[model samples]
Target chain A: MRKNGVNMIKISAKNVDVFYGKKQALFNINLDIEENQVTALIGPSGCGKSTFLRCLNRMNDVIDICKVQGEIVINDFNINDKGCDVVRLREKIGMVFQKPNPFPKTLYENISYGPTIHGMAQSKQEMDEIVETSLKKAALWEEVKDRLHEPGTGLSGGQQQRLCIARAISVQPEVILMDEPCSALDPIATAQIEELIDELKKEHTIIIVTHSMAQAARVSQRTGFFHLGELIEHGSTDKIFKNPDNIKTQDYITGRFG
Target chain B: MSEAPHTVKSYEEELKNLNSNIIKMGGFCEEALGKAVQAITMRNSDHAESVIKDDEKIDKFETLIEQQVVNLIALRQPMAIDLRETVTALKISSDLERIGDLAKNISKRTLLLNENLPKNLVDALVRVSSDVQKQLKSILDAYLDRSSSVAMNVWESDEKTDDLTNLCMQEVIKYLKENEKNLDDGTHLLFVTKNIERIGDHTTNVAEQVYYLVTGKYLEGDRPKGTEPIVTGEK
Candidate 1:
């Protein structure tokens, strides 16, 4: 992490490793994520990219045998410390996953749920305002404003993904983690979500794990290539795709080898 | 790092095909230039006709290579060296095509020189022709070897070709001034020398492409050059 007299890093991971019982999934890794920029993680399957993403918000804690050893510092405090509150940590770091698993609730309820639980809105009028603002930010307000009471599952796959994004931003998380969020959608829908991501990065730091190299190239400023449990290379997206420093990364991105 | 084969076998084949096509096209340019020189020096109109006819083959090669390059880009979406090589193939093919055309043009100009030229003027023009051919051969070799240093050497050697052209031009102008009947042969010889000089220029363009393909950077600064002789009859 380089300050160089300015605080550009939003998250810094040092010597981060993860293990699932007797099987080690991630090696020692260090990366500094810049503020308000989209950093993409790319690799073949079983390369530990998603594992690294989960480690950011301590999502791996749910796995009974999973253990993470890391000094993942955010804003100069190590979040891996025992004193760190997992709930509060999650509140500050929102996530949208591979599937749009919005709860079986109304559209309005979906957006209002997080803020309500966190006491973000004090009155009915404020909750309505939060719902409208979040939906508008997600670019879904125009399509879903008339159907606020409809089930979130009733929307199209792309619309539901946007609803998930709206829910993520309703609580105003500083960092958003997206794990293959566009894999399940059609090209048109994917482009919609991609456009929304371009809009979202203005207000949040986003880390995305993707298998699509073209998507990674189009959407990210910085890209990291992972291989066989190791971070092989990380640099500007242009260099990674055009002239990477590491052969493994070059091979992977250029489809010479996995 | 050791080179690894692409996972898709056909993609590897396409790239290899593109490479071989470029080399083949370069060979045609060389053959055409050889015949052009033969036509001029031997004063053989038959050789001039053959050189002009063979140029069609070179044009067909350019078309084939362009198609291959386009398919490779659209399908493989090659990156890094692959991308550079693909782009260089397109550019080098164009330059080689022009070389073939210039060679054909030289042969065409040779057909008009019915009057016998001075031995010294013919010798000087042939010298310029051979020098430009040497530059062309070295640049093609640089492309084949993927050697930036060799490409740089070829790039720097263009000055010699230009200097030879200037001397050859001065000789042809002097021969033209010696007799009014020498004007037709002398002017045709002058155009021939200019065509060869233009071929040297195109070869340098290929050298720049080769350097960029190997090193991912264009050569810095202007290319070395020699003074050009002023033409009196053209004005």
Candidate 2:
């Protein structure tokens, strides 16, 4: 169904399967990530939530033995097509990991790294403008405006995460993938990152892989419960948390088992 | 012992049983309140004695439903609206149990005020008890139907019961100040009125639970706005 003038199928996957050489990691999965909204993928430790998340941007392709099947269409373009520009596709899709892996450089240089490498910036002044805008978009400009030359590693854990987000936005990506981005931070820092995620949804479609159901409940608009290498249930956050349709989804949400 | 195929009942059947049990318990409590009021108004200690005898049945019903609620939660693991319904049943059953106690208190008062009060004071007490009885019935109806509008109406009716109880208390205290002849009877009358008012309050608690069961939102400290204005002196 269409909502708020946007197509319902922002990203569509049909009968998608992934294999790591001899072992199948995902089986006949199907899901859709809507536009300008956060969709949380939650399951047990090895239920392929992170693996499926990686498939969205073809991040799993780097693993030598991994092979993906079926079509993953984003904005009417099939990403699995051979002629698809993987580099340009990645430029429009960004990723953040479990740990806040900021580059070992100044905050300004870190945020500007993507645009500079992509040749998106014409001059040093343009790169500076891009850095400032990206930092502002990530809600970190004021905290590090005077410390632009300071090393990103000098900042605290939460600050480093926000800096990483600033770097993601620096490239002007359409979608941002967060793989347990707040798992390393304290509650207060997690709350800050969650609030930033909520704000960032106004401009970017986000897909988060979270081990914490409470975090998923707090930050996500939609949630997909994964189980045993399959997408079990995907629905509105309220339904998923309150009255999931699937028994396994209910059991997992209520802590019956992993 | 054989496993016996683990004869499991459907959740719908369990929910139906819970609803019927609540209604049955509510009916018994309603009858107890009615008879207790009659015993006070007619000076018939036998009716009060019967109500006191019926308290045991209400207690048993409360325990039965309480166990069922626990079983429902343990077995069904209900979510969302169903979860709210189970939690509300647990709370409402406890409130009903307390209302049963309040009925017992009224019967005790009836035993105390056997033949001492004058006619006018008894009339005022009868009016207060009757108002409480009507409000309690409406609250029970609201809960069973899961009607927010009816629940809101019952909540408003509780204020009327409160007003009647206050007036009854004021009349009793006035009579005490003037004569002091039936002070003990007046005090018992006050206790009975307070008990009935408390029953009204508990019924409103049940009504609030029904509201939450329907809406999935707590009605804590919230009065529904722009409801029909409560008509006074028109019970």
Candidate 3:
């Protein structure tokens, strides 16, 4: 495991590959994700960034035909171990999808969903406190505090996305994995989520899969570029965007061809 | 650092155009300095007038090159080596324009010295001018070839022009003291010598930009500066 000062490796993947029956989706991918920092995965469409991200919390196990092969260890626990509890693994490694998928429930119920399942709170008062604190952490408490009984789907696209984030953090996960969390939002909404990601990294290790290079550059400290289902290069954000060593990375970042 | 060509052909063409314009500006400044030095040595008012007129073209070159750089940044949004190349082009264009101005300033005094000349002082000025011209030409080649060592050679030898100018200023002062009747001519020669030294400085400026362009950082250590007085031979 690589260590940098006070930061430690929260997740590390080696020789990770994904496949769907006859077709391979990722090939020999390896990377390290530091604790309480943002690591962004960026590439063109169908480049397997999303496929690789699903390996973090064993999200690919849900698909009958999809097979993930690799060692994805989070805090010394192998996520792909045969007997590893998938529900418990997902709780510690929360995921936010490309679309803002808030459950068709009340706003308070959506934030309270994970804590209820995990028995994080004992009484009604404790559940109310968990909901309030999670919303505050997601920066949506002040906006949606008045109408806690309203449907989560009734909120705006940006607000619904924030509510989903609040739901993810309600479980108090150690790592939050996001897949194009702002693709459906407008520019203003995108900026808001980008800022939230930066803030979220203070408490949770975040891995984001984004199609927007600027978004990756803006939000993450370390950036990994993917091409043709292979992890091409990864480094600090400035070096990757300003002076990447690989030719493909240079072409993609400079807009020569992507 | 061998790499394949860019996939977008038109962006490559725009970058090539920017490079060609920098080389074109370099050629204009070189010719202008050559003309200024020749006009002073041969005492030809016509050559000095042409050098002065050429300054206008150099100024226009800087304007056009600046526009090209801005457009490339806005349209193509270059990164890595291309970004460094465009930024250094902007800096080199500025230095070349300043060199053209110094050459133009020298030619203005060459016109003033169309009267009875100081032959010995002009000879010393010619020696110093030739040194600066050599440095300028070498740096232009270094920039075009993307050779940091060649640019470093020019950057290191900049003090030679300053030392040569210092010696020539002494000769001019002595000639002025010995032949009191040619005081005004000797004074113009002193200004011409200082202007040549300034041109030497601008070439070094362009050399620094070339170093940064190739390596993506400033050259290690401080740049050697001219310590000799502007027009006096004082330490």
- Native contact fraction, candidates in order: 0.46, 0.16, 0.43
lDDT by residue (B56-97, candidate 1, tens digit) is: 999999999999999988888887667777999999999999
Complex DockQ per candidate: 0.51, 0.13, 0.45
lDDT of 2 by residue, B93-193 (tens): 88888898999889988898747566777777888788878877887887777788887778767667766777677677766666666677767776787
Candidate 2 residues A1-258, lDDT tens each? 357876466688888999999899899989989988899999998899999999989999899999999999998998998988888888999998889999999998898888988999999899889999989987789999999999999999999999999999889898999999999999988988999999888888999999988889889989999998999999999889776777778667755552
Show where candidate 3 strays beyond 4 Å: A1-7, B1-10, B114-120, B176-183, B224-235
Evaluation by lDDT, superior candidate among 1 and 2: 1
Where does candidate 1 stray beyond 4 Å?
A1-7, B228-235
Tens digits of per-residue lDDT for model 1 on A1-258? 236845399999999999999899999999999988899999999999999999999999999999999799998989999999998899899999999989999999999999988999989999999999999999999999999999999999999999999999999999999999999999999999999999999999999999998899989989999998899999888878776788788778767884
Cα lDDT, all candidates: 0.90, 0.83, 0.88
Highest lDDT scorer? 1
In candidate 3, list every pair of residues with a backbone clash: none
Alpha-carbon lDDT of model 1? 0.90
Q: Candidate 3's residue-wise lDDT over B52-157, tens digit each?
A: 9989999999999999999988987777778888888998999999999999998898888745556676778888999999999999999889988888999998
Clash pairs, candidate 1, are none
- Report the poorest 10 consecutive residues by lDDT, candidate 3 chain B: B226-235
